[model samples]
Target: MKISKKKILELLTSGKYVPSTFKAIAKILEVKDKDDKKNLRKLLKELIEEGRIIRDSRGRYVIPGENMVIGDIQFTRRRFGAFVSRDDGEEVYIASDDTGFALDGDRVLVEITGTYRDLPKGCVVKVLKRGRTRIVGTFVTRGLFAFVIPDDPRIKYDFYVPPEGFNGAKPDEKVLLKITRYPSPGRNPEGVVDKVLGNAMDPAVDLPTVIFKHNLPEPGYFPEEVLKEAVKVAKPPTKKEISKRKDYRKDRIFTIDGEDAKDYDDAISIKKLKNGNYLLGVHIADVSHYVREGSALDREAYERGTSVYLLDTVIPMLPFELSNGICSLVEGEDRLTLSLEMEIDPGGKVVDFKVHEGVIRSVRRLTYTEVNRFLNGDNDPDLLKHLEPVKKELLVARELARILRDWRKKRGSVMDISSREVKILFDEKGRVVDILPQERGESEIMIEEFMIKANETIAEIFNTQDIPFVYRIHEKPDPESIIQLKHYLEAIGMKLRIPKNIHPKVLQEILEKTKDHPLHSSIERILVRSMKRAVYSERNIGHFGLASQAYTHFTSPIRRYPDLIVHRLLKKIIEKGHFSPEEIDRYEKELPRIAQHCSKRERIANEAEWDLLDMKKVEYISYHIGEIFDSVITGVTKFGLFVEIPEKMLSGLVHVSTLDDYYEYNETQNILVGKHKKRVFRIGDGVKVRAVHADKTTMEVDFVIVEKENNKNNKRNNSKNKAKKRKKKRRS
Candidate 1:
């Protein structure tokens, strides 16, 4: 008798087949020869590796089932537990004791043990693959023993380093370590120092530390082949290429961005038509034009997924020759673009539109500040002169933007959530000088409105054509989250009725009602949290946040990989009119995986940026220890209250131990109550706090309550404090 891989899979998949050991399977198949048994064993091993079959604890070959899952494990920020994110989008919770030495981001086989808090609870049965081999941390030595404390808070364990593995690394310095041994039930992981970054306090080491910590690509380092391809692809638009594209080189088209922005990926132009409609043209850099599909440049860009813009630095997705040179819609340079021209009526209805590959030379480059100043009636001669060329265009753009914004609001878009963005200013020596909250002026809003309209227009086009496309989808809020939000809202004394199947319009109404409330920011923060995160998807479920039926990111191809893919898809449609059946099938199979990869990469980039920002914030606040600031409690937990300083957008924890009275956390109401004094601290409570400590390594700030002002409101607390002081003196 003979055995084969196909036969093994068929047997396992058969309804009558029961899980059996290698010997049992061989006997059932009547494999009497020794060589046939060896062949059967090899086939079984290959099938298991391919995930076509799995093994039970008793070493029997079985099919994967609901009781078992394979997924990547992500530890919580507090490191108490982890969640395994499976391929089908289900998350299983893994308690700390059940983790079986699995680290963050490892792919593991988990056996579903039971249920925890409405989610499947699981334990790691086997670690299929390690997610990371390198870690960035601070090296320390104590009495002939050494270890590296990881900078990532999610990574809880300290990797032990042997004396010979130090590799000349010094104490308290940031170093990159390569893992030599993984952890087990009883032992810690071990690593060897690969490179000494520098002193933790050195400003020069900040970028490298964050880069290594996040496993980001080194800035300005491109593979030789990628660079060569970039150089070949970044050439100026040739005569033949321009002849093929719609030429808008002489149009009054220009770009508006931040004063410091260099990669101008999007440009705009507008005009009022005779029928009182606005002719708006949005030109985005055609990044896919240069970086062909499956090329080295495209592969590198896909791997990066998106550019990481760290404060004062950037890790770009494409090489400089493409991202900053030819692909950037620089002033007075003819650059290739995918243009969307829309005819919007006064009521903000898009009556007609056209999408085309075009060539445009930006007439001028504008900044948000100058355009805002001119629009706000600032009469400075220099400012007026700087924007004189396209003054009418700017005004028309403003008019059209207002109409579009009002239309979006009328359609129930979530528009009133005010987000505070802070700009960390650095001095000549790269030291933090100030942290100022950035204001979005009218010009900023105008650009946002235009971009949104363009994105919606492009998305609708592909969706109507029934083409396989990547969409920027924001699903509706989960009913469970909305219920929690409703309870919290009631607790905060806002009596708003929430429906089980809530609509985005209801959320909009809530924001409108709470716009002037003292806890507006806190409410906004909570509402944002209650909503699901927006991600790229091949399935168009509509964007709940923006109140759009179809939406995609078609702008900023220079920075975002999805936009580049959109461009390629749009170009394919424009050139071929429609995809062949085979092409459609291929894209249908590929787009979901691509969307998932890009979504994961985007999340990593966002986390890295936030981590670096938090580090800088802690560094800045370290200079202001003991200074009192007004703050609002944003979160309540058993351990402490998380408060954010509203003015600077800096947040810190007010530990329970730091409170004067012994407090008990009320989990149901999400509040903390003093055991004897009856003092209550809940979300949105205003308090005066003094910054007590800041830890750069942990990226955490500690705040202590300043009782002087708070005492004025509570005489009992003051009296209790005096009584305690008197008792302490008598005891002394």
Candidate 2:
């Protein structure tokens, strides 16, 4: 058996194996064969690289003691940083000066420098791996040498580019630079231009730079080999293929998506059974059928992880021939799919379910607005023409959706968290028209409920079968974060009792109780900030957000790589009784790494989308500069207050310096109070502000306070002065 790091550490720590050379250690462990000894050496090297093992002066391997820790270093804007332990220990605080050459996202060996207030303080002792080799920045010429300023603020050093490394990049042009040498004692890191990305002001350069910076796929283009394969496999399913699967063409099936949606990966058909149970058939595109394992398409899908939805564009995980054309469950098209046929009771319990490899023809393509309007009783003739037979099905689906929603709420889902999705409208010239919150009506909720149920059903099946799988896990909130959130809420006159062992329902109760309060959004925002980000993991740790013991992404395989993986894993179970031991072992060994990679890629996609959105938001606000906007304080920091315009969905900073009176930040109270003027600005407080400045490059908009509506300090001061004058007159 291959020895794992844990087993090796256990052996060393147990004092069963003497600290010796790798070969000697191997002999002590009864690994006598030549191949076993070689394998043991490889494992030792892996441990050493992971910082779990070290060599003494005599070249004997031993586990690193308590002083050292292995983890990924996260650098913040303020020079200080934190080391998130790879072994899942509490995060160690790293002072700015102690960070040394470790950059953000780098895996390093941290030596515990000391402890501050029960928190472990660490200093970087060794850089195990570099997170980035290429940096994206704007080129600037300084006499003889060119310097590239990184767009990411976390990167502290600018790259010094020699004259030969310019690569035809003009000054102020965006460029991707490759670091040739890291920073030395008194010098900056040296780099050469890898790609010239044209002028920063050009509209075309905006997304391309973000793509290159985030290492996303080349926009709208697939590899020639992948394209050829996609073209070959893009044909419609044949007679034999149709004969082997269930056909759902005659069922009043349809897809409900955004009006601009091109890739429809999931379609639904709901019907009421004779016994009053609901039959919910959620058909997902069978992407695994076309993109086989180890194929070029599969490799590219794995690399992209998920489709990135920018303001108006989507960088799809699959090529257009597959993602948009063949694999997309478009209207009236005979497409291959995997359907989760669930029989849910009136009480929102899944009574029974079956997974099927099927073929489906979506009868209609209805947008969310159309379905929402129909549900709201506005049955326009034009809308009726599109929604036809599926209208009745949608009604049944809506009832089931309400039942499912109630069930989920009872199970601990946080229903009061306001949706943060915003829609950015652009004109024909690609200029911003307006920014508004994306409406979440009943139709959207119905679809969401169905998808959640489908994903949970699939997760439960695989989990019960004891097969290797990937789960979408959202862990409970950290204790420290919960404590901080409670303190913030208490400062706002809201009370939150956090138990020693926190549950999602415990937090959900607080949100539900304050759902109608004026500060509901602020409380929900803090709660969201306090929770951990959901990620893909091989272990089924349960989804805290959905409050499901078993949950995975099973709905949008064409867009998500993990869903595609789930489809493949499920197909193996469907075709064969179960996956072979070898197959199961392979998945067990590889899935954790795949989960990490997909999670990282997902973050990149989110960051890229957010970056483009911020660029557009800045651009939109730049046009309205000097105009006053009614805003609400969303956040308060030492630097200033963060205020958002409700109507426009635009957020800008109200800098402390821009305030007329001197203001002091009360961190514990979570507010800014003017010292003499006594004007108070706390989170959720409404105020009027003028957009003073906006920078597209920085993606920041600055706001100046326009008016202080309730000037209590002025009235109080006037009263005091009058009383003082009256007293002086009486004395005279």
Candidate 3:
């Protein structure tokens, strides 16, 4: 068996001294073929390179006991930078000295010098390897001296660039630079500008800045070979293909999506059976049909992992030829799809189900707005009497959607909603003209509800067949995070009402209470943030958000790679009936790694999206500096209360030191209590503020609390707030 990296580290720490001789190690390892010097040399070289085994003064190997072990480098940005020693998927603090020469994200060998209680602390004695090649930053100049200030605060060191070394760029330009010379002695990290995009304040540069910062793969079209393969979709599921599977093309099915949606991945059909049961068919685009395994297109899709839609632009996984054409379930087009046909009883219970590959013909491509308008009593050319049958069935679908939603929630689904979205409106130059709220309505929710049912049903079917499938699992919130959340809510004058079992039902009652209140959005926002992010995994852990017993992503295989994996697994199961024990072992072993990769890719996507949104928000508020507004405290720290404005809904700090009263921070309550006046400003409290400064370089919109009196006597308070805001802006 091939040993894991952790196992290698474990062997190094087992004994105080490991024999220097290869023969001794081979004997200890119980290898009968002792004369195989090549393999033994390879092992020795690997160990030395990894810093597991070290050669002492006279060439004797020594395993440095429990004090030394190799682990990944991690950095946490606090007042005093703390590099992690052993996170083990949890936070474990280590000092900067512990990091030694190990770069961020690098796997290194460290000597565990000490421990504070149960917390493992270490000092890196060796550098195993380097980590990243790219660095994202903006160039700044002071006289003749120039430096590249990193956008990521976690990057502890700045880059020093000589005037000529910048390679043809003026000061204050946002550039993608490569680390040419790492820090040595008192010098900072030095680099040369690899690509100069534009000025830091240029609106067009922000998207590229976001892309570079997250280390997301550059958005590029698939290669010629991949495009050729992707474009080659089987003409139309032939007579032979139809004979091997079920046929749903003649079924009165239709797709509902956004007005601008190009790739329609899912379609739904509903009909009344003679047995007094409803037949519901959930049809999905068979993307795996054309993008076969081990192809160039497949590899690119795997690398991308999922489609990334940023504002109006989409970085699609598969080329447009496949994603928007052959694989898209367009209206009146014959497309191959994986269909889930289920017989639903009057009570919304799925009595019987079958999964099959089939040909589908979508009768119409209906937009949510069009359907919702019709449902809400409005006439349209597409639905003015000619679409009466489709419209009536749409209402029936909504009713069925309600039944499914109720059933899922009753089973244990946490259905929560929040009003937090950036609706993009771009001008002719692709510059953002406006960023509004993306309103969620009943029609969208109906589609979501049906999709959830389809996914859960497929998960159950694969489970029953003993097939290996990728499940969209969301584990419970971290115990520490949950505890912190509970305390935070309590401090805000509310309680979680969590029960002993720790289920979504604990939050259900709370959700129902604040359905449409002003603070409703904020409450849901906090709750959602408190929960862990959902990720793709082969293991089936029930979904916490959906509150489902079983869940898998089967609806959008065209965008999501995990869904494609699931689709392939289902097809295999359909043909072979079950997965072999060996195949199960392989999947079990590989799943953890797959989950890790998918999670990382998902983070990249989120970061890219959020970074762009933050830039846009910053730009949106840049014009409103010095404007006054009403606000409420959304966050509290020792430094100040973070006040969020009501109009634009942007958050800025109201420093405690600037409150015109001496204050002390209360750790337990997350508040700053004024000493003399006894004035208390805490999280969730109301406060008025005025925007004093908005710095584009820092992307910070600063605000000072609007005190009733700001005369000559209050000069110190105004100065303090101004000074604090300026300091933060400069640092950022």
- Give the distance in Å from residue 408's predicted Cα in candidate 2 to where it truly belongs: 0.7
Residues 38-129, candidate 2: write the lDDT tens digits: 77888877887667787665778877778888777777744456554464424788888888787777777778978865578888876766
| Steric collisions counted per model | 0, 0, 3
Q: Model 1, residue 587: what's the lDDT?
A: 97
Model 1 misplaced regions, further than 4 Å? 1-63, 114-120, 667-669, 709-732
lDDT (Cα) of model 2:
0.82
The lDDT of each candidate is 0.88, 0.82, 0.72
Residue pairs of candidate 1 with colliding backbone atoms: none
Which candidate leads in lDDT? 1
Global CA lDDT computed for model 3:
0.72
Ranking by TM-score: 1, 2, 3
Q: Which scores better on TM-score, 1 or 3?
A: 1
> What is the TM-score (0 to 1) of candidate 3?
0.85
TM-score, per-candidate, Cα-based: 0.89, 0.86, 0.85
